[model samples]
Target: MAGTEGIDITRRNKKPRLLTDAERDQLDEFVDSIHYSSRYNDDHYEYRHVQLPKAMLKKIPKEYFDGGRGTLKLLWEDEWRGLGITQSLGWEHYEVHEPEPHILLFK
Candidate 1:
């Protein structure tokens, strides 16, 4: 059930249903394509050149889990510093600002 790709429908007097072999193969191809792209490589590849700490890796969100290679390059200036890290070992720092800032609280 875990790895099977199919819809199981149980009627009042019938057995469950399942996807055909063709359907399973199609799904597998789709998943393989996703991993072949750069995003998946970034997420799963060991950044042996950088050696990022475990704490920083844990901060990454689910959306970024598999498709965030290019997205990481666009992080805000403050965010980079807050994460206590830098992009690439020899890159220069650049200042950037959020397009709009709304104060949510006045405490």
Candidate 2:
């Protein structure tokens, strides 16, 4: 018997993973609910997922420091936030200390 190849295999088998009707509807709703804001010329209502590295933690600027104690102090002084310290959304990996809002995304 000759082994299947190219389009023959695709025609014989269906995708292993498939989204249900409800799941597809929910995804459509999520995509339609996005809204844009004019405050900063950025769409504040978009959803994004990103992961940062430990070495890039030293790039946060010195303005969004909040001027408080604890981890904030370390970030303000050294411009680097210690790993496994606190849970901050705006500054997930590194403490953001700059006035202008900045976001970094990696593909």
Clashing pairs in 1: none
Candidate 1 RMSD to the correct structure = 21.1
lDDT of each: 0.26, 0.26
Deviation in Å, model 1, residue 25 alpha carbon: 44
Q: Could you estimate the TM-score for every candidate?
A: 0.23, 0.19
Estimate, for each residue in 1-107, the C-alpha lDDT of model 2 and write its tens digit. Answer: 11122112221113222334543443342333222222222332222322233232243223322334212221211121221222233431222223322322111
- Candidate 2: C-alpha lDDT: 0.26
Q: Encode model 1's per-residue lDDT on 44-105: one tens digit a residue.
A: 23221222333334334323222422222222323333333333432222211122111000
Candidate 2 segments exceeding 4 Å error: 1-46, 67-107
Q: Tell how far residue 78 is off in model 2, in angstroms.
A: 23
Task: Give the lDDT of residue 44 in candidate 2.
Answer: 27
Best by TM-score: 1
Clashes of each: 0, 3
